[model samples]
Target: MLGISFFSVVSFLLVWELACRNGVVDPIFLPAPSQVLERAVRMFTEGTLLWHALASTRRVMVGFLVATMAAIPLGILMGTSQRTRAAFDPILSFLRPLPSMSWIPLSLLWFGITETQKYSIVFMGTFAPALLYVIDATRSIDPLLIRAARNLGANRWQVMREVIMPGSLPQIISGFKVILGLSWTCVISAELVAAKEGLGFLIMNGKEFFQTDTVVLGMVMISLTVLLTDIVSRVIEKRILKWQA
Candidate 1:
């Protein structure tokens, strides 16, 4: 696996460098791999690259955590109670179709071009769908398990906490993994308006200056960061869901 990964990356970089060097692709439109790497190195030495990457990462984490924290409980409640489900269904339906970009206007109005506005955009974009995923996961728990828990003298709250929550946690975590990726996409939209530093901002700024290298670097950074985060999430999931795995 390590060998394959190394070779694949090496081959890609080689082909990319060759393509630009040989004029198969225009450097102005798509900067050479070396140019992008040089920009990355310069940015790193200057510290702006790290700052932009961290800013975007922080936004994604904060928004994703807040959205997950809010969604799980509400979703569990909706799944467990018919009344709650009925009350929330229409609202969820309304919000679910709204894209992240749609929330930017209202978020900016509410938070006024602050970091909070960016976080709000991501939260609003992710929350509805995340809640629905949790609800579905909760509902999919076997009714027989609930019945057994009740028969064993578990109260409603006890059953929810001990039986339902535990039963649904694996799926909930999996859903959050998907939501985390979505949050990154939302971060881009969030930065589109007024962000001064973030991978998204870097990309936008690069475009205005016709610096394709910076734009490419921004995109590559996003993908690499997402991959790293995915690895962390998977490790956490494995540890948390040890019993199931």
Candidate 2:
């Protein structure tokens, strides 16, 4: 797998470089790999790249963490009890189809054009979907296990804490991984509106000046950051669900 990935990446770079050199594509729209790398090195040396990355990372973490924390309990409640599901279903139905872009107007109104507003945009974008993932995870647990726990004198809370939570954890973690990636997309959309410093801002700003290298750098940074976060999530998942497959 590592070999394939490495070779594929090298091949892609070669293709990209060749395309630009042969005039198969316009450099104005797509800069050469060397240009992107040069820009990346310059930004790194100047320290602006790290600052923008840090700002976006902080926003993603805050939004994703808050959204995940809120979703789990509500989702469990909805999954374990039909009454709660009935009450929340309509709202969920309405919110589920709405993309992250839809929240920009309301988020701007609620939190203004600040980092908090950006966080809110990501949070709202990810919340409903995360909740649904948790609910589905919880519902996938076996009813027989719940019955067995009950027969063994386990209280409702105890069953939930011991059985349901553990059984659903793997799925919940997996779902959060998906949501984390979604949060990046949300961040870009959010930044497109009012951000001054972030990968998304870098891309939009570059577009205004026709600097394709910066735009490519922004895209590459997002991919690298997402890959790093995915590694961290995988570590957490391994630790938390070590007993499971």
Candidate 3:
């Protein structure tokens, strides 16, 4: 599988490079892989590429972590209680439909042009979805498990700890992996306006200068970063979900 993937990528790049060289595609619009690599090397040597990547990564992690921390307990509560779910349903309905970009103006007003504003954008964008995922995961737990725990003289808290939490955890983790990727999109929206450094900023800057190679490099960096984070998430998932294996 790895060999096939490698061969496919190599073939695609060869075709792309040849198309540019043969004038079948405009270099200004879509540069060759070699040109994108050159831009990457230049950015790395100038010490901007890593900085931009780290900036975006930091924003994503902070925002995502905060969202997860808040969402889990609340979602569990809502999932377990009809009243709680009813109370929050309207608010979730309102927030869930809104895009990350829609919050930019309010976040800027609330946090100025600071890093907190960027974090807020990511937080707002991801929090509702993460909460919904957790709620669903929690609610998916078998009623029989809860009843069995209760029959064994387990209290509310004990039942939750022994039955609901364990039952829901695997699905929650899977949902969180997806939300982590969504956080990247939120961070990009955050950076596009007020950020001085981030892949989104790098891409916008490249566009203003008509440096298509730099723009492509920025996109590639985002994809590579997301891929790296997904690998890490998979490792962590394995560790946490050993029972599943």
Which number leads on TM-score? 3
Give the lDDT of residue 222 in candidate 3. 97
- Model 3 Cα RMSD, 1 decimal: 0.8
In order, candidate lDDTs are: 0.93, 0.94, 0.95
Mind giving the per-residue lDDT tens digits that candidate 2 earns over 1-245?
99999999999999999999899989998999999999999999999999888889889999999999999999999999999999999999999999999989888888888989999989989999999999999999999999999999999999999999999998899899999999999999998788989999998998989999999999999999999989998998898888986
Worst 10 residues of 3 by lDDT: 188-197
- Report the number of the highest-lDDT candidate: 3
Clashes of each: 0, 0, 0
User: Where does candidate 3 stray beyond 4 Å?
Assistant: none
Q: Please, what's the RMSD in Å of model 2?
A: 1.1
TM-score of 3: 0.98
RMSD of each: 1.1, 1.1, 0.8
Off by over 4 Å in 1: none
Model 2 segments beyond 4 Å from truth?
none
Q: Where's the lowest-lDDT run of ten residues in candidate 2? A: 236-245
TM-scores for candidates 1 onward, in order: 0.97, 0.97, 0.98
